[model samples]
Target: MTVRISAPSGPFRDAGIEALREGLTRRGLLGCGAGAAGAVLLGAAGDARSQDAVQPHALAEFFQGHQVAGAALSPSGERVAVLLNIGEGGARRMAVDLIEAADPSGPRRRVPVGDFDVETLAWANEQRVMMRLVIPVTAGGNTPTGRGIANRTYELQSRRVVSMDLETGETALMFGDERVRMRESLNLGHIVDYLPDDPDHVLMAAREFSGLMALHRVNVNTGRADLVERGSQLTLDWSTINGVPVMRRDISTRGSVINIFVRPDGEGRWRRAWRQPTAQVALADFIWIGAAERAGHALVAARIEDEDVLAVRELNLDTLEYGPPMASRAGLDVSASLVDARGRYMAAAFYAPRLEYDFVDSDLGAHHRAMNGFFGNECNVVLANADAAHNRFIIRASGPRDAGSWYLYDKAARHFEYLGARTLLDTRRLAPAEAVQVATRDGASIEAYVTAPPGGAPGPVIALVHGGPESRDVLGWDRQAQVLAAQGWWVVQPQFRGSGGYGLAFASQGWKRWGDRMQEDVEDALAQIIRDRGLDAARVGIMGTSYGGYAALMGAVRRPDLYKAAISICGLGDLGDALAYERRDDESADGFVYDYWTSRIGDPRTDGDAIAAASPRLRAAEIACPVLLVHGVDDPIVQVHQSRGMNDALQAAGKPVEYVEVPGAGHADWEDDVEKDLMERYVALFSRAFA
Candidate 1:
């Protein structure tokens, strides 16, 4: 995929870059030569005239354009590193810029790197920033040969890690050896912790030849590493506190259980802290949040048997018992926790109708209130980072209608300065997503978000189910939902029964349910939305990606009258086929796949009847609504053959179906032109079906 980087046209075309450069130059921190930096800047700019020639301020502009993916504050809070997207469509690349915290206005030094795109950025110290680069790979060249373990067979682009000095613009690859690169390609070997006391090194977990992960103390300046601890064969995850690996999780297939082991002093044999049967794991176990301030104690999130939502609680490592509840919401799960640089628990955040943060630390609480009061309640203000003294903070403020902006707040000066928006967009034209509860046919209350057009009037409804059936629609800015709303469509994102962030009961209900209870939740939400908004049921359609795509196809087959059209993007059509493919490619132990499928999805051997019944390809004849199938030819998750199989089945069954295969696209990855084409096709298909 080739992304084009051309200068964008508009009044504010060079405003952001120029302002950043000027601010840094004025502060006497400009590192790169102006002439060389200018060339890079010019190359990063898009041809705004060309964009305008094709379409002026088209809805696609919102989808196109550069964006600030992430930012990090220096230890001294004197500077911030922002990761910015510099190109459009396939040619898009991520660039890191260092901006002065005092005056984040003009041109800043942009870190020079190779052709690889910046995936993530973090401040290693006051003067150094760590970067993760994503190296794109071709599908054909990276395809697995099916001879190795499933886990090892799957191909992935290499994620190279590097660190750079802000003052001198010097860079060094943290881990770029063949072994490190190979492990990274398989999603292993990552910087787990940055030892704050030792700025020269970071803790990383990398898989060895034994296929077991081991902790390594890696030098940041040189690609040197030292073994810290060898992980158990069954170790699935590990946690660290104060640069010490204190806890680790081991999965055992004996009874399909997960064992949590703890090493109080980070030495000697690991003692079992807790264990849960795999069948009861998702619903009954505690999710390790972080190591607590107090030794031999840790923070965890779990839902008590009597509780309807998950709550953050303190856990004693020695006794494996719960302490006191730190944070909880009546109908929502405590999604995340905030910890300070000193490892002190500060606050807990939950998402109900919207994201709400409850500060546990008094100082952080006061800061939260002050920032919210200053930014207004509409914005969800998050304290991203703070200085050692805790007087200066980097605050990220965003809402359903807002596209996120950064701010620097100084407690001593009682001053707050606006940094910049992640992306410049007209919020007035965007729609706000409202959380609503819908009752399922089985008497279950599922949470969902409704994004309607500017006016509150009812219009065409699109059931946009999120992927992962394991993932839920959070209260935030959803690009696709907003784009659809701009096209006069009410986008309904349902937090189906099996969706995550809703406690174990809700998510576990989705296992083995697939086309049954899972798809029912989508239909139930759409029905309730139509009734609540008085929307025309005949104008409603179903659409989703990944598992959501599967749900969309199943919806058309199960409830043809409810949806006039169905669009599946990179969706699974055959459960048995998908399971088989996973079994062949997964690198887990012999019985791991079987056990996981049995517990999460369903045993293909024992549940073959149910799997066949739910397979969209097998039930193509029952699909009465017009169907549009979109797939990425290089999709690593759900193979492109699934879409091909569904199309063939639909044609053989004499049903109306349209299939679009995107080349050089993996899973949900697509360029601007591909996205625009898909959007146009959606508009045409829905318009035709609704008409």
Candidate 2:
């Protein structure tokens, strides 16, 4: 979630920074020896008290509290469009509306896309759009799960392609597919994209049985499709090759490789155009923006890297020559738009780490005030390069306390006004966040945040570890972390090595060391905060979900002295079990998965000793702290037995362990009500144990 970021002004900004240092030093002293004195010392340093305003609420109530969706812009930069829904349907009902960009807050004209479901929507021109609509189908009898409904499927016969006139509010059916190929409990109509140059043609790839992908080109005019290619594993990317539109397949290789395929030159045949190197680079790391206005087949690509800014490169197909990066360092997170025939204006967005609204302007300097909201850093922009100066864009905005909304930014008015329904969130109430930095065991700097209950003395701190050992913690509104702090405990989120959003080198460093220095990163974060006296060293707790959960379990077993309590949610108990069970149908994806774990954790067969040492279940006996284990029974990703078996071991050893099972939930999407219940239980349990 996005957290509204501002350079804390007035006396609060300086005061906050000072308080953090004092709190840290006091906590550090307590960790060394002094206990009560350290707590008091830290308490005396803070100016603002933790607020106790947020009351417990139901998750369903929270879902109903807000509207969420994306806003789209017209190519001419005159009109802004957005998708909105009225009621809460599992499959959201969509309606596109157009509003005047000059008077953004004014009324809008609504255009209904369809009733069944808006599978995909793409702009055909400034006044027209292509949409894929599908009818939902359900099986006759109940499967075995809990709900009485049959498996739902997206039958080809149940889908129709239609074109809508934005200016006239008229719709026309382009094509209809009536083939019923596969029979699964639920059919997913995977609508990937529409041909960039032609609205009558759409590109779609579906996962057939046995994990093979069926790539098809559907003609909107004829409703007929031809299978261009089929592969056991293929990821497609689209772009212009030699001025001709083409499709590129990400095929199996060392890492990820792209093979460009061009349609037969005037002969109605297909041939390979150019292939990217296989070892180090992946075509997905960069997306083609638009070709230069010049005559040659020069294409522009947005190159993705460790840094936030998007790199622009000029690609020549005939000579296969690539130009140096342009538009580099556009204030960290820089998004760009291609200019039109006149080259009058180009739209772009730029952002930095300090916390502020994303700037979306033709000159890249406008729209700061409109973008700045609570957790504004969470806002993302999608630009439509429809002939350059005339462009359409979508902004998805959300934060910890607020659901996200989409806005349409039209260059004509120099404003991005609000569009329709937005994604609902549960961030009505939240706690203040304290940004701080700590040192790793090796003295390398680590960034972290410490947040506590409002109006409360510096209390117990929970080492809120993040998953993705490859993911980094950015400044934003975090519901889970804020909720813990509201419960009177200090929340600490550490960005350890292998965390992205930092740089490529740092993220890749965690490649093969999951529990070693990676664990040290978490430990150092906790130790530094304790040394600073921001939290009670004697009553510290460590908790994480997914990868974070794994870290919590490992932390408890490896160093119980620093953490008195541990919470693990959907954590992996056995590394070997994960590698074996985590295989997808694609062997290449699976191989990379296996390589990542085994190289970092240990190979069960080759490095049996290391795997056993790293697996939490095998080391459960070493954990002396109280542990809370939560798992979802229906989790398709992480097996539930990972938690059950570990809990049993702890129980057998006479250790304090509580196991909570979510009956019909998955790994991350636990039913909304279940999330609230879990939060309440965690808060009460931590308060009782720590306080």
Candidate 3:
């Protein structure tokens, strides 16, 4: 029940406040309510820096110093707004920073929003930015309970969306009365974009009020919304093509059919223009650059692949004719994007066995030796980061052992210029990490990233599985991954069967095969890692949140010989129960949502026996390791009872199990110190367990 949370250092706090205030001012915000904002920032900074600053350990270095998150680039690429983390005393607080794109090395100044932490930051204009803040809630508030959907006097910390001007330090409340989507809950998922047709209008793309995902139009200046599109029979995947909005909706519960529709001029009525025949195993990629310079029409670059071959094609929106499939490679890979409006620019990331991007410009390539940071002489100039333009111009560069550094190029200048580097932890200060690809006993290829302790002499290792078993890991700046490495645990993140980023076949490999191939992927990954690298097989443990949490329990029970300790945070133990609690019978809520789950996992009714066999609760007796379970009492995604019931069953079975439940908390949060508490507790527990 009691958890010890870690805070940032004293120096971090002083710098945070100074940085936050300067950031706010530079972004054109006058000031937050001095009393409330100051108190919250001070409190958060104290929490983050409670422990005295000592030797710069990797974990300490990762979260201790000046850090930035939630970064958005202005449309003109002239300004950048970033979220800054600063510590006061021992607590950590969130503040905003605005930097001129020309001189992004340091912010002109910081804004001091003492009471609010910026969750999602966007550059509305070069002079104005949009920021959404977390509203705090008071505890021990009286409630008036009632039957007819009682209007409970909820103690909500009112959050308001504001547009702040950088030049004059002017702040205007934008969407004050509009209800925000819940923080962590998959709230009728929506994508908000500034309307191209009307400067004051914004498009709110999301599921309808009935809960099926769709697109809606909202007047940004006036708090008004009109339903523009209905939810798809399947899921609507939103994308922007050439400054135009295009939605790809998978029409089958099993993810079979896909329809692509485009909204003319980014705000005009959306109509079906083209359709990609949805095959069971085809992975597709689409990117739209701005209107073509010569043609003055939308240009969409797309690529589709099946288990056998990968094909790339260009679609001319005006003519509606498909370009000949250029590079028909054999592999589940291809990502394309336009560099800019010019028809000559193109950038594509292709993965067959390895990962790299192909940058091309027809005229530039034919005449130039080095075109826009890309050395035409050699393909070995591995593409690290690309700008959002159609050509995919290189914006940053790094290698296997190097941390990425940003670079800017002015085409008129025809030369690459150096920009200040954005780094989380100093890679040179940290030990080297190895990449491992293991094949499951079932003959499936599984990929993972492994970082050993600094001294090379192997000690304990932690298997860090990812949530969204549907999502996969790519080489990038992952904070948690770096934190685990700093903890001296060889952090192992396995791309299990159901994980995306892989081809469709590999991703769908987990459909209806949960706890089978999925579980086996973790086991196989660890086994190969132990064999190839000298990991202390006996000292290995497991930890994850959500779906990852479920795997921790399943691994402990299924292979007691491999894991000695396990930690599960908000993981589901019973799929049947989880589905029942989260899903509503209302078709408006989502007709295909339940069907999608049933397809990925067996139906609890017809496949009751399989469901039971795959569930962790059914195999609790096989668990041999000590376990730690953490849950939020009000988690909407995976009900809190999943962990509660498992704990009770473990105690009844005479197993060593401990549970820590936080009140007034949901699934998980990145905006509050409560989240840091949850993570720090798990680390302490794992360290103790290993000891």
Candidate 4:
């Protein structure tokens, strides 16, 4: 279901920066050239020595694609299906490895799907697992084929969901009704619920030609759907409690308010229990997770005015009131609620800038903590999936020095068996990260992570601003951070304001204050780290993607004294021009997209003064450092124009700027072979800049 980003991050951008807006299905399957699935890469007993034995010079190859694209736990939790990438470069072939939870090292099942980029892997039932992927529908959007309908050519991405029998390896396409193809919905394969209770069917949501959001109970085997409910324009995500349709979240047509409603029973009247404006100030962060055991009771994650940190709480459906905190981590805010198959809250997950979970079930929590101890506590231990009886779990453990590996953990037997590595990189070479807090203007404090060269010697530094100005930096095995660190530069990712997961008050201060307060927070963190780490100030360079890219260019424009070099990958140049693009010929202005961008960033139509003061392209004359711009030619999110305009502005101002136009690339090219080459280019440029 499409959840309105309480705080939209990349691909979740509220119509703000198209570049930040991710497609409904971004499974890393760029248009074409996916080879046949005839070749198998990894299996139950596959050797990972090749992945682990990556040569020092070939370390960048690890950044090409994910070794473990995704992992799904079977309904019975007896088996964990892992999607492993085969071969090299962007469009790597994929194979599914079904490892036994009892003994992962033993013989298991391997199913290969050649050239298909499987974005998410989920269990349709105990005997079935389904994969969601994007298909290149070249030729035309509405072309008729004997098999089915052909969506828009490469101009727009089409999606397909495949259901496979774990035992037989036979696969079927989901949403397979030819009867509904002519209806012309935007996203055809939108899955809502897996329906563990009803293994034959799952809930799906699709926007019809009438612009109404409808829920369908589709048989995974037959692909026939029966319409369950059709909602209004304001009403968006449709959700189910257990196997019953009982909840729906809506954003006002104006996009200023968010309303959450729950049904006492599937047939009962809708009750409004939560309402909050999109504004960051004076906000009450509440998200409906699942229905509680009681008829009118529900579980939710809330960060109210009294406490900025999120905690799991009980919401009374009848009285529309929240009960006491059911589960919370002291001093740390909860990022998500971990629920069981029956939709009961079992734990609260937070990022101490890393993966940390607090289980409500004391025994489970203790066992999880024990697993962490078994991993030496340096690695992040997560119970990715568990059996119906909670007797076994799929454990994922990773750290800065570890690429991460899956484990089969037997709770009853207290046994842990290694499954496989999560990536192809030899992560043991990554530098350890240190957390630091720096005070900025207005008595505000910011948290950041600094990874210096392993030798502890002071050297050049690079301030990597994270994307989603709404998105905050997370701690763990960071690929981008490690890539630059490998080049002997100190990298500090500041958890700047307006970034999510830091409570609303802190994040609210960042709303619509970009290029000023938010920019100051980033600069303050870098200044403090430079002083403390003794990094050479003259050699410092700033870099980032999307919003981070915007920030990178703006940093050089506003404070050239701090940066000697800058690089912006697919970054936006003009904030005002970007928002203006979102508002042009688009859907109603009242929609979330238009409101989200205008709300987060000032509207160019009305906030011209504010936008002009912040736009890097408009003030290119002020940028004094050598800058670099890189963009994907086929990027649908943020079009190539943004980077092109930025490069034009810099060159017009007689500034030193190098522009790299990546052919056949989109918003994210991590899976593409060029990613490695581009990464190497970055290291070289910084090497020369800091020389």
Q: Could you say which candidate leads in lDDT?
A: 1
- Among all windows of 10 consecutive residues in model 4, the one with the lowest summed lDDT is 30-39
lDDT of each: 0.71, 0.56, 0.55, 0.70
Which lDDT tens digits does candidate 3 get at residues 1-691? 1111111233333443453433221221111111111111323212223222322254444444333434555555556555656656535466566666555444456765554645566655456666665566643445556644434443445454556665555665443343554332233333355543354545555554355666665544444566665656465655554324554444544333355665545565556654432322233444443344434245554544334333445555544565655544443445444343122345555542223545455543321224211211111223332234422223433322224333344333333333333344433334344467788896766778776544444667788888766655554445565566657677787888887555567667888777788888887888788777787887889988888889999888888887888999888888777656434531323444566677777787788788787788778888998889988887755678899988987888888898988776777543335555656776777777778
User: Candidate 1: how many backbone clashes?
Assistant: 29
TM-score of each: 0.75, 0.68, 0.66, 0.77
| Better structure of 3 and 4 per lDDT | 4
**Residue 95, candidate 3: C-alpha displacement in angstroms:** 7.6
TM-score of candidate 3 to 2 decimals: 0.66
Q: Which is better, 1 or 2, measured by lDDT?
A: 1
- Give stretches of model 3 more than 4 Å off: 1-66, 70-115, 120-126, 133-159, 175-191, 194-355, 358-431, 442-444, 576-591, 603-608, 664-666, 670-672
TM-score ranking of the models: 4, 1, 2, 3
After the best TM-score superposition of candidate 4, give how far the Cα of residue 397 lies from its true spot, in angstroms.
3.0
Per-residue C-alpha lDDT of model 1 across residues 1-691, encoded as one tens digit per residue:
1111112334443643454433221221211111112211211222223222221124666665446667788767778887776766535666777888766555688865545666677887778888877675543334355575332232346666778887787786655555545543445367878777888888877777777778888887775778898896677767887888888888774435677887667787788866654434534446777777677778887665577677888777666677766788665677776665555566777765555678765665665655554332445677787676676777777665566766667676655555556665654445656788899998878888888775555788999998876667777767777777776779999988888777667778999999798888888898899998888887889899988899999999898878899999999999998888756654545555456666767887788999999999999999998899999998866789999999999999999999999976988898656888898898789889878
Model 1: lDDT of residue 548: 84
Residue 609, candidate 1: C-alpha displacement in angstroms: 7.5
Question: Model 3: how far is 55 from its true place, Å?
Answer: 5.9
Better-scoring candidate (TM-score), 1 or 4: 4
